[model samples]
Target chain A: MRSPTEAAAGADDLAAMFGRHARELLRYCTRRVGPQLAEDVVAETFLVAHERRHRFDPSRGELLPWLYGIATRLLRRHVREEVRALKQVPHVPDAGYDDAAAHRVDAQRDVARLSAVLAKLPRRQRDVLMLYAVAELEYAEIAAALEIPLGSVQSSLHRARAKVKAAMSEEDNR
Target chain B: MSRTDPDLIAVRELPPGLAEPSDEAVARVWHKIAARPAPRRSSRRLWVPITAAAAVLALVGAGIFFLRPRTVSQPAFTTDRETVTRVIGDLRDRAVTAEPVSVGPGQVIYQTIHVV
Candidate 1:
């Protein structure tokens, strides 16, 4: 059990951690969502981590994976909010294809393609894949961040990897 | 390159030259983090002055309300000065209730019934 003093000290340390890692976390979120939504998601993620810092285990390898987990949760919430907001408007795109203008740059084209494929995956599978493949977190760390059984991580990772690979290949054929 | 292998481990990696948050983005995040008071310490510091000012004002207001006597509402006598002094003494002889209640600034009520 932590003393009140220890908890207070932990909050200060977490503030420092946020300052050092927020940009990297924002960059990571941008690759998942579009750049337009990245900063808001990053800010919300850290604010959440700050409020829940007591749950954070300092024994954990690095704080980045934990922040990624928070960012992933925020991204899902962002997507759901966007969907609800767009439902009011007419002519929703079939696959959430942002206009070509948004994907004009070569790198953004790749990101847009990848994002479209990612949007098709089940939420669980997309999360597992992003944490494992994009954030480069190990299976154990991903499980801890997600608070799920380790075996589930393995299964989700396999399914997500297969789907993304197939999608990429099909895109190449076109 | 095995272009046909869709089931292969696609090695999803960060693309080269992926867009990073600009220097401005980093600065904005840093400024926010820095602007926040180191958690508990900052919250404590922020409340101290506010709490102190509230307490001081409360004490000062209470002292002013209880200390001053109600002179404005006292009756003025048009009779002779001696008779007025005598009447004031007689009014003082009766039990006068001077309990203060809130009404407005610079005004009060004092009720005294002369027992004949």
Candidate 2:
């Protein structure tokens, strides 16, 4: 049994962690699954972190990747929802007539194409790609987050990016 | 390794109205994290058996206190000579003053005696 003081200290540490990382993590989840499910994913991530706080080793890596890893694992349960949301992106109406609006429409089109490609990616590759592109973690951090070899992270990211590029080029051709 | 790739940019750009999490959402999640049950340490686990053993010992002690053989204290009349003498005197006076009955020819008499 942890002393009351030790447990309090652990809670404080987790609260501090949440204060720092919750927003970024929320944004990341929102991108993977829409805003509706993002909050749930973020909440679960922190709860899992609190449950497994004893297993955390600061010497291994920073805390963000660890949290991302937990969120990523939890996201597996919603893979179908996420892919469906991605595939639906292109169909959403784009409404505006201003220059900024035109730019946004073009961006949305590009994003829609990327989302389609992302939906079809293998789980590991998509995870690596999202972590790289959205969370902006370093290769080492991605490795730590996913608990995979550094070389594996590198290769997965490479393959994921290449696939996105190829898909985008094919869209351009059409 | 340029982050400027259009596809990467597209991935980074969130859909309309999807930005940083609202304060309410963050607070809701933080509440959950804060409200989580604290992890029990090994020492805490030891309390269960320790408490149970203490309760068992207490029950055993209570059982011994209640069920053990006891020495009966002597009654006051037996312990005090004056009380015993007084009681005997009263019994004798009552017997001396008791009414006598005529016996029928076929009837048998039954008497109860108290030995001091």
Candidate 3:
């Protein structure tokens, strides 16, 4: 068993890890979901990471892959909840921001377009793409983070990449 | 062009532009975790049951004392109806005595006096 001092050091290391990577995690969340909910999702991801630090393998040279995995799962849940909520609401005209100039329609359009494409992908594929493209995890790291076989990671990533590319090309053609 | 060709690569992997977490974010998280009080000492929590039992015992003793029936002064009487009636009659016949009698369910005479 680790000594008390060692355990405390471990906890501090976890905190330092989170302090280092939280912003990137937030950006990934913003890309997967939107900017408005990114902070909450990132905070929740670190909370889980802190609570589950015992599960981490220190032998891994880096912690970002695991942290990204956690953030990916959280973003998935956030997006699903958002989509479910949207299904119940009627569409309405966009209101001007309280400041009237900051809430650009272009930003809203981009968010809407991304949301529509993300909502249609399989959950596994979406997770793979988000981790690889948005969070930028390597294949080996993604495999370790997801706890899946290496072969599975490669195939899933390939399928996810193909889907995202097709969707982007289709949007461009229109 | 083949889909995987380098020149036709539609998706570009940008350099990680991640910045350090804001001081405010770090401080907020650290403060929350640090402010959590240590687990209560086992000795203190162990005293809870013992203290509770002692309190319960004291309350029960007090309740028994307060709720116990009280002794009140009451006049003694004979059990024999015939003897009681004879004695009552004898007293009534002598000295023009007046004795208390029950006139209603809970009401009683206020005075028993002998008058000449």
Candidate 4:
């Protein structure tokens, strides 16, 4: 506790960072991969974040983006696993929702199709789109996270969305 | 969903109940790491009023670090770059592909991230 270096990384800073964003990052990891691998991915993310906590420039952006960048890097290690799980489209977590119609929404078919389209997107586009739609990250946050220019973030999101739309439309017609 | 872009609709339909890591999982992760290493000089600050302002934006009990500042600088954080970089370098090596994912969208973006 008395280490001169450790003082820079107060437990409050690490705890503050983790307490603030762990749940959201976990859920994002779960959706990207699945529950089985999600914990590993999330755990690795925090471990990396903790080690790199010093490199984190709060002035560069909020911590979530940096966390996402780390999480995304970890996810890349298991991209094959992620693709496999997405192909399965596990049952929606909220089984108790009131709407019978929600149950009938054909999530399996749609997610499977989306997964395939996502597989084909340029890695940047996919990253941007996933951060935008899935993580609900703002453009600036994504720019910081992905470390691309703000313009690139917007363009990648646009391209990614267009490609996804095209692919989904193809599925609908089929 | 049908009325929206099919892609948007499909993703939007995703239920929010994704499973999260348990506290036990978090503890195990924490146990893996030893003490925080030495600190290198970093270009960040924690102006008190900014921290308090960032806290006010909290939803529930959660608060985030607000990168934007309305005040002058505080102390530069001493970061442990050597150790951290090695750890991430290991991660990059362990990665399935040998590409730098932290910076992508090509060389321009990669250089920009490093330069900034």
Candidate 5:
């Protein structure tokens, strides 16, 4: 797997760079905007990363966070679609099921419930939350990736988690 | 009994229905990547910003040079710092040794009051 630094040095190395980060970035994008538009988002992200490769400094941070930041900016353009997609409740009718199948449905219901709650969060909070939850970035990484203060990351994550927890309990009650 | 935080629970429990990037997309990016210059060092036109900034600094420096008030430098009273120090020392001795006249025989002062 090529580091972004290597990719930045030469365009040919981008394939190597993409080979490294693309899978995770794709999953992140997919979770945000669903599968259909995820590739478009990732394509636009790498292209932008290529153009702005000059700005990346390995000493300051890693390329993954920088790529996330770039991918996120592109995702912002599709905020409406993302919100709509995330809010979609998979139309799985509840039927008498084996224990494992019932557990799967419950999990899917939780995911759907979380999605609706996530859409209602403030844009800034939602970005912080989704990046943390979906991308699996640490607080420090998320801070660097978002160019926000570590304190802000903590606060935003706190708020986001609280909202998700509250929404989950509400769903459980229903 | 539940020690897990909501976020951790969400991560472990909520599986992502993630979409993989299409092979066509990968190939498209691959071709785009191939079309790029394969040089090891990323090319940055360093001279452009550096030269522009240097020019701006030069212009500002020149502007200050032309616009600021000029000081009139005077010829030194002594040729060197040693000469100036010697002169000051001599003047101090002469000042301290000279006695003031007692107008009424009441006191004799070692230094003159008016000159220094």
Candidate 6:
């Protein structure tokens, strides 16, 4: 059992950690699972991190990747929901004859198409791709986040990018 | 890292709405985290169930050990004074009427008796 002082200190640490990384973590989760489920994922991520804090080896990598790793694991439980959400990315209707509206429509179509492609990707490849493109983590950070080898990360990302490129080109040719 | 890659551009252009989570959403998450119970001492939590399980197992084992049926080695037939007397009388009668038997080098006699 933790003493009162210890509990208070742990709470303070959690608060500090939340303040430091919650926003970005939330954004990353939102991209993967939409805002509706992202909040829960974020909360659960922190709770898991707090519970497993003792197991975290500081020598391995930065705390952000660890948080991401935790979030990614939690996200696995909601993969079906995520894929459904991605496949259902709403298409914005053409509302006007202006260039801005035209651009918005084109962008929306691209997002919808890309989301469909993402939904169809294999889970590991999608994870690697999202960690690279959405979370914007480097190869080393991605490897740490997924607990995969650096070579696996590179290969998975390469395959993901190739697939995405092929898909986008197919969409263009259509 | 190529800026001209259409795939990268499309991925980067997902939507502005997903760029940041609302402040209220963040607060709700913070509130949930703050409201969660403190992490239980794992050893303390685990010891209780483990001890309980061991005790139940011990009790079950004791019940089986004490309640199970037992086997005893006994004679095939019941023995009584009357039966023993009758057997002895018959053996004496047979000896009186029997012819004398010759003894051999490797031959031996075996006998069984029931005692009460």
How close is every model to the real structure, measured as TM-score?
0.52, 0.63, 0.50, 0.55, 0.60, 0.67
Predicted complex 3: CAPRI docking category: incorrect
Give me the candidate number with maximum TM-score: 6
Residue by residue across B17-99, what tens digits does model 2's lDDT show? 56677888777766766666765567868999999999999999999999999998874445688988998999999989999
lDDT of 5 at A1: 43
True contacts kept of 4: 0.31
Off by over 4 Å in 2: A1-12, A90-108, B14-17, B32-116
Pairs with steric clashes in candidate 2: A1-B41, A1-B43, A1-B44
CA displacement after TM-score superposition, residue B43 of candidate 3 (Å): 18
lDDT of 2 by residue, A1-174 (tens): 445454444544767767778998988998889777888888888877877877766666777788999999999999999999888875635647798887777667777878788899999999999999889999998999999999999999999989888978876785
Q: lDDT per model, in order?
A: 0.66, 0.82, 0.62, 0.68, 0.74, 0.82
Candidate 1: give its CA RMSD in angstroms.
16.4
Strongest candidate by DockQ:
6
lDDT of 5: 0.74
Native-to-model Cα distance after best TM-score fit, residue B81 in candidate 4, in Å: 72
lDDT (C-alpha) at residue A127 in model 5: 82
Reproduced native contacts, each prediction: 0.21, 0.65, 0.02, 0.31, 0.23, 0.73
The digit string of per-residue lDDT tens for model 3 on A12-55 reads 47567666776677666655554446667776777777777767
User: What DockQ does candidate 2 have relative to the true complex?
Assistant: 0.33
Instruction: Give residue A159's error in model 3 in angstroms.
Output: 1.6
Rank candidates by TM-score, best first.
6, 2, 5, 4, 1, 3
Span of 10 residues, lowest total lDDT, candidate 1 chain B: B1-10
Error of 6 at A19 (Å): 1.0
- Candidate 2 docks at the CAPRI level of acceptable
